[model samples]
Target: MHPMLNIAIRAVRRAGNLIVKNYEIVSTVKINQPNIKNITNSVKIELEKLIIDVIRKSYPEHNIITEMHGKIIGSNKDIKWTIDPLDCISNFLKCLPNFSISITLTMKNRTEIAVIYAPILNEIFSAVRGQGAQLNGYRLRCSNAVDLKGTILAIGYLLSLQQDNQKYITKINQIFKHNYIDFRRTGSVGLDMAYVAAGRVDGYFYIGLKPWNFSAGELLVRESGGLITDFNGNHTNSNNIIAANPHVLKSILLKIRNI
Candidate 1:
C-alpha cells in the first residue's frame, strides 16, 4: 500500500470504531431522545478531529478538506485529503446502517487513493490509482450488465438542492419509462458508489454532490473497471455523477442526455 493510503486506513479504522460505538448506543436509545442530535454531533466532531490529527501527524504538509469543517490548507500544495467523517447523517441518526466514512487523497487535483468504510457492515472499500479496487481485501469488479432492464440502479437525491428536484424527477421518470430498470435512493452517495464498484448495483447517478461525498467513490468505481463522469461524459469534480461499467455507462449516458 502507498504510505499515505496506509495512514488513511488507520485513520478510517479508528474513526469507524468510534462511529460504531456511538451507533450501538443510539440504536438502544429511543429515537425521540433529547440527546440524539447532540450525540451525533459530538460523534461527528470527535471522529473528524481524530482523523485530522492522525493525518496531520503523518503528512503535515498535505491539505485537508472535510465535510464538517470545510478546508484546512497545509504546507504542501500538491496533495489534498478530502474527508467525510460521517456520510448519510440522516440515516445514521435514524439507526439505518447505510452510512460510511469516506476519505480520498488527491495529488495535483487527481484522486490517487480512496477509502470508504462502513462500520456497521464491517466493510472497507479501497482503491489506488492504476490499481484495482478492493472490498475487505478482495478485488472488485464492476457489473457487466449491459442492459438496464431488470437491473438495479441507485440514485441519490440531494436535499440541499431543492431547486433541482424537478430536473431529477424528470430524469427519473424518463429512465423508468425508457426501460424496466429498478431504482433505489439510498441517501448515501459514498455507499452507492462503493456498491457500484462491488457490483451490488449496476449503476449510480446523482446531482449536486459535494467533493467529500463523491471523491473517494469516484476512484473506487474507476479502479474497479467502471466509468464515472458528468452528464456530458466529461471528467467531473463535483455534482452530476454517473458511475457504471463501460456498457451500462454508455447506455445510461444516452438516457441522461435525452433528459
Candidate 2:
C-alpha cells in the first residue's frame, strides 16, 4: 500500500468506527426523531464532524470536502480530501448496514488516494492512483463477465429531491428494460462502487451524486481492473457516474445514455 493511501485508509477506519458506535443509536425511521429532516442528512453531518476531526488532528494542512460542511479547510482546484462522511444514510437509518465512509485525496483536482470503509461489515476498500485495490488485506479484481445479462448491476434513485425523483425514476424505468442482469438499489453509492471493485457488483450507475460520494469508489473501480465513467462513456463527475467491469462497461454505458 502507498503511504498516502495508507493514511486515507486509517482515516476512513477512524471515521467508520465513530459511525459504528452511533449506528446503534440512530433512528429506525427514514427520518430521524425530533427532527423533520431525513435521517440521512443528520447522520451525514454527524459523521462529517468525526471525519474532519481526524483529518484536522493528523493533517491540518489538508482541506476537506464534506456533504454537511460543504467545503472545509480548502476549496476547489486545491489539494483537499473529498469525503462523504456517511454514504447511504437512508440505509444506515433503516439499520440496513450498507452505509460507509468515503475519503479521497485530490491533488490539484485529481484523485490520488481513496479509502472506503463499511464498518458493520468490516470491509475496508482502499486504492491509490497506481496501486491496486484491496478489501481488508486481500487484493480485489473486476469480474470476468463479458455480457450484460451475465452481470449484476447496482443502481440507486434520487427520490429525496422532487425534481431528481422524476429523472431518477425515468432512468430506472429504462434500466429495467435491459433485462440482462439482476439489479439492486442499496442506497449507498460508496458501497455500490466498493462492491464493484470487490467483484460483488458488476456495475453501478446513478446521477445527482455529490463529488465526495463517488470519488473514492471511482479510484477503487479503476484500480481494480474495472472502469468508471459517465453515461456517455466519458469521465465521471459529480453529476453522473457509470462504473463496470471492462467487458460490461460499454453495455452499462449504452443503457444509461438513453436516460
Candidate 3:
C-alpha cells in the first residue's frame, strides 16, 4: 500500500473503534430529535478529532475538509483530505449498524487514495489511484448486470428536497413507472457506492452530495472497474453521482436523461 493510504486506513480504523465502543450505549444517551442525538453527535465529533489528529501527526502539511469541522487549510496546497467521520448518523442513532467512516485524499485536484470502513461489520473498502479497489484486502469488482429488469438500483433524496421537489418527483415517477427495476434507499450514500463496487448492488445515484460523502466512494467505484459520472454523464465530483458497471451505467443514464 502507498504510505499515505496506509495512514488513512489506520485513521479510519481508529475512528471505527471509537464508534463500535459507543454503539451499545447509544440509546442510554439523550436524543435531540428524530435523526439527531447527543451521543451520535459526540461520537462523530470525537471521531473527526481522532482522524484529524492521526493525519496531522503523519502529514501536518495536508489540508482537510470534514463534515464536523468544515474545512482546515494547510501550508501544502497540493494535498487535501476529505472526511465523513460518521457517514450514516441516522442509522447510527437507530442502532442500524449501517454507518461507515469515509476518507479521501486528493492531490492537485485528483483523488489519490480512498477508504471507507464499516466497523460493526468489520468490512473495509479502499482504493488507490491507478490501482484496483479492495474489500478487506480482497480485490473487488462491480456488478456486470446489463439490463434494469430484475436488477436492483439504489437512489437517495437530495439534501434539500424542498428546493428540488419537482425534479425529484419526476425522476422517481419515471424510475418506478418502468416497474422493471427495483430500488432502495440505504440512507448512507458512501455505503451505497461501496456496495456498487463490491457488486452487492447493480448501481447507485444521488444528487446534492458534498465532497466528503462521495469522494472515497467515487474512487472505489472507478478502481473497482465500475463507471461513474455526473447526472449529465460528465466527469463525477461531489454534486451528483451515478455509478455502476458500463452496461448498467448506460442503461440508467439513458433513463435519467429522458426524465
Candidate 4:
C-alpha cells in the first residue's frame, strides 16, 4: 500500500468511527429534539477537524481542503488533501443510513489516492491512482452496461438559492424518456459515484458538485474501469459529472445532450 493511501485510510476510518458514535445518538433521539440541527452541524464540524488532525499529523506540509473550513495551505503546493467529512447530511440527520465520509489526496493536479467510508454500512471504498478500486479487500469493476435500458442510475444536485428546480425536473424527465430501469437521488454524490464504481448502480450523474464533493469519487470510477465525463462527453470540467462504463456513458450523453 502507498504510504499516503495508508494515511488516508486511517483518517477516514477514524472519521467513520466518530460518525458511527454520533449516529447512534442521533438515531435514538427524538426528531423534534431541541437544537437538533445545531447538534448535527457541530458533529459535522468536529468530524472535519478529526480528519484534518489525522492528516496534519502525518504530513504537516501537505495542503488540506475541507467542506467545513474550505482550504488550508501548507508549504507544499503540489500535494493537497480534499475532504468531505460528512456527505448526505440530510440523510444522516434523518437516520437514513446513507451518509459517508470521503477523503482524497492529489499531487501535481492529479488524484493519487481516494477513500470513502459508509460507517453505518461498515463499507470502505478506496483507490490508488494506478491501482484498481476496491470495496473492503475485494477489487471493484463497474457494470458493463452498453445501453440505458433496464439500468439503475443515481442523480444528485447542489442547487443554489436562485437555481430553478423545475429545470432539473425537466432534465430528469428527459433522462427517463429513455428506457432506464430506475433512478435514485441518494443526496450523497460521493457515495453515488462509489456505487457506480462498485457496480451497485449502473451510473451516476450530478450537477454543481464541487471538487471536494467528487474528487475521491472521480478517481474511484476511473480506477474501477469507468468513465467520468461532462454532459457533452468532455472530461475537462467535472462540475457536471456523468459516470458509467464506456458504452453506457456515451448512451447517457446522447440521451441528455439537448436537455
TM-score against native, each model = 0.93, 0.85, 0.92, 0.93
Which pairs of residues have clashing backbones in candidate 4? none
Error of 4 at 31 (Å): 4.4
List the global CA lDDT of all models. Answer: 0.88, 0.78, 0.86, 0.87
For model 4, how does the per-residue alpha-carbon lDDT over 1-259 read when each residue is reduced to its tens digit?
8898889888888988888888889888776767867887798889989989989998999999876788899999999898888888888988988889988888998999999999899999999988899999799999988898899999877667237455666767877884846998888888899999999999998877766678899999999999988878998666777999998898888877787
User: For residues 12-115, what per-residue lDDT tens digits would candidate 3 score against the true structure?
Assistant: 99989889888877757766676466566678789999999999999999999987788888999999999889887888877888889999999999999999
CA RMSD of each candidate after superposition: 1.8, 3.2, 2.1, 1.8
- lDDT over C-alpha atoms for residue 28 of model 3: 75
Candidate 1 per-residue lDDT, tens place, 1-259, comes to 7798899999999999999888888788776678767776788889999899999999988899876677899989999998888988889988899999989999998889999999899999999999899998999999989787878999987677888878888877877885888988888888999999999999998988766678899889999999988877887575787899989888877877866
Candidate 3: C-alpha lDDT: 0.86
Error of 4 at 78 (Å): 1.3
Off by over 4 Å in 2: 27-46, 74-78, 160-180, 236-238, 255-259
Tell how far residue 16 is off in model 1, in angstroms: 0.8
Whichever of 2 and 4 has more TM-score, that candidate is 4
